[model samples]
Target: MTTSATQRQAAASVKSRPPRIADRLPAEGENGVFTESWFPLCKSSEIAPGEMRGFGFLDGRVVVMRDRQGEVHVLSAYCPHVGADLSVGKVVGDQIQCAFHEWRFNTDGYVAATAIGDPAPKACLFKYPSADKYGVIWAFNGETPWWEIPDFDKPADALAIRVEYDVPIYPIDPWVICANTPDWQHIKIVHKIAFDHKQYRDCLVWNNYSMQGRLDGYYTDNKGGALETKAGIFGTSIFMMQGNIGGRWIGVMTPFGIPKPGHTSTYFILATEKGDGSPADQQIVDQTLAGLYHLAKVQVGEDKPILRTIKYAPGYLTASDAMLAKYLKLVREFPRSHAGGEYIR
Candidate 1:
């Protein structure tokens, strides 16, 4: 057969297959930085008052420090003077004192003092927009954050929050993991979640920076129970779920971090409403949170096999995949920047 006829025969024979597409969505557009989203660096407990720790971030590094006054700060890791890793230094009062020359740097990323007594050179560290929330320390990629970290409807003080951070890093882009939120099929198949018969267009409420929907049904897994979940995927790196499990209120917040390209770190924030200030009430609240934590672990465990190996391309999507399609579009349009490159290096 001729080349054209052979091509026609191949097309006619193929029934269904993954469509040709990009490997993964664009994380860094023309700007050469990960999407402008809040990235969790480490747990708040890791950096105690008057302590500092360094972490690998999007194509760079950062140091997290808590001052003597118990305020947390995130800044570029390397010192301007002779390029020392500031995390090796000591936290002196509100400033970080570089171990090399004992150069003291303030939270604003400017040189505060130098042990050598020379006029402190006009040097500065890249101070990332940082926050301590959901039991994790987070830093935004851009100079200013587009939005704050999301919270449950109730005030934080009204809730009991427990954070778990021992999860293994996944060999996938952060956004690819966030895609699981709208992947209804995976929800039903992997996590045994059976949602009521409602389409994405009917349930999803999309916004500029987030999308949320409610799923109501029972887990089809052997240990079945009723599930009423309201979940949101925010800024390509955070997921929040408020739900009723076993007739009790449960809340989960999962934030993803990119240690570098093709790798993701995660934290689990499990929460429940506070009860009356009685020992018995506290015990009940504790048990509820423990159950929620176990559930979160089980669901994530189910996802590990696929996420670690997925070379994500939307491929042959159907009408049922409308939610995933919408999410991908938002990810592409999301802002990106490498503003900290100069200093974080």
Candidate 2:
């Protein structure tokens, strides 16, 4: 059996990438970052008013801060004056005061004041277009964002109770995570869950996001009163579920790529329809909600082991892989992050 030179080179390339998250920049002609898309900067609840914190984005870190008025801002973490981590500094009024030199930076990234109590030069920092929605702070990697986060099927003003769960870093590209949403075979086999699922391509009405769709599944292990659970996926970043048993419940996973390439973190953001209840009944409702949250957490846990050892290579396809093939095509066509523009983080 002779292995051709091309085949040997392909094997070697796969071997080169360590199991750890890919940290190296993509070689020339590779699309490393998807621009004109929203990458989560931080959770809205985590950044309190008059507070500043840093979170990883794209291939670098961005500092998220809430001003006194509770407006969130995302910007480069470094102080352009002296390279100090701006997140470590304090927020004064609507601006951040750098600890190293007391330099002040406004939400617009302009140098407000210098260390010597003088107006600074024209040097300014980079600011990203950010918005607070879906219990997360979203920033556009490219300016003039091409798409906005889509809303759930529910009403625009429904009182959805949001509970967010922080997921640990997993070593996988964002696309890989999104691809798992429509894996019907994995549901019936690996997870031991059974349900009817049909993956669809994003076309007219919902062309805002990528090629991923809903998973309508119910746990086969359970006895009578089968629970009705519905999931919605938008790209690789957001996975959502609406479950009905004793009450209505919804869960969303808003994932974002970190400064480390090929590594991503997810927020298992959960929500429930606010049921009217008295103090005594509210406690019972809370307990039930806790169980649902745990279930959602467990489902996310099941994916980690698979991602840790997965490789990017050609696979023998069958009729079952029909949807996955389309999903990959959408991922490939995703726009690349550009070097200029406000989004070039």
Candidate 3:
């Protein structure tokens, strides 16, 4: 073969070779493993008093329950003795008693009690580093301790209206929703807004974004609407749209994702009209929840299946997917294991 033919064959061979697994994974040095960051796993309402529920978050099975004092505790679903599911146990006072062998664990995951005949288990159930903040339970599944849970308390306090809708989780990776916030073209096409064209046109240009460590923030057009929104993508959580609407309505989208062993679930808390003097009365909260449920059923339900089918091609990104790239970048920076960090309640 001629020299050119030989060079062409070598290039083709290199192209045909399978890429390394490390290349397929998110860049570790840049994004860090996500397991260490604080991620909102479940709403406080989801864990009723004395009820133990199994959930997936941080790519593992976690059992969360509320004690008689109304505080939440999260630990491995499996018991150390005989591998029974801790979720099946009863919540007694602050301790969770294993239904199988009656091994009990306290709120801090210490072995409180065990059966007389059973040998003391050498290993304890893996306890998740958790904190209760803003009516939600935040857990860290990574190797390093999360510094501080992102504060949603201020927004929650400011809103005159607070709404929570328990819509069916769209079976899509959390990144899809993260990507949607900044994707302007999809808003006009999918949402079908009949609003101002100039706003939509300007948002498509990626001009306002700043990244600091694990957090990144950006502002985009609310599709010519009265809403001006900003999104702060933190590790796996989304803190989006923290601005006023119509000079009165303050809105924020605090998005969270929890990964189970077999599936993933996501939810958001929308607080509007923040910093207003009016309190979120019971009636207002109720109405907000109802409206959110309706809106989610229409919007998230529509986006769910479509997002579920999206394929993430390795090393392929377009300028239009700037938000997604930013999200992926943050994800890569989180730690995979909890090495050292204090657990705050």
lDDT of 3 at 275: 32
Worst 10-residue lDDT window, candidate 3: 210-219
Q: How many clashing residue pairs, candidate 3? A: 22
Residue 317, candidate 2: C-alpha displacement in angstroms: 2.1
RMSD (Cα, Å) for all candidates, in order, is 3.0, 6.4, 7.4
Local distance difference test values of all predictions, in order: 0.85, 0.64, 0.55
Error of 1 at 226 (Å): 1.3
Score candidate 3 by lDDT.
0.55
Distance from true position, residue 300, model 3, in Å?
Answer: 2.3
lDDT by residue for model 1 (1-345), tens: 999999988887785655576545774423467788998999898988989999999888899999887888889999999899998888888889999999999988899988989999999999999999878999998989988788887789998999998468998878888989888888888888777636544788888789888867788884438878788898989999887877888889999998876789989988899999799999999988888888888888889999988888877788888788889989988888888988877
TM-score of candidate 1 against the unseen true structure:
0.92
Worst 10 residues of 1 by lDDT: 22-31
Assess every candidate by TM-score.
0.92, 0.80, 0.68
lDDT of 2 by residue, 190-297 (tens): 555666544322321234365434444556655212445555556546555555644455544455544456676666555555557677757655665576667666
lDDT of 2: 0.64
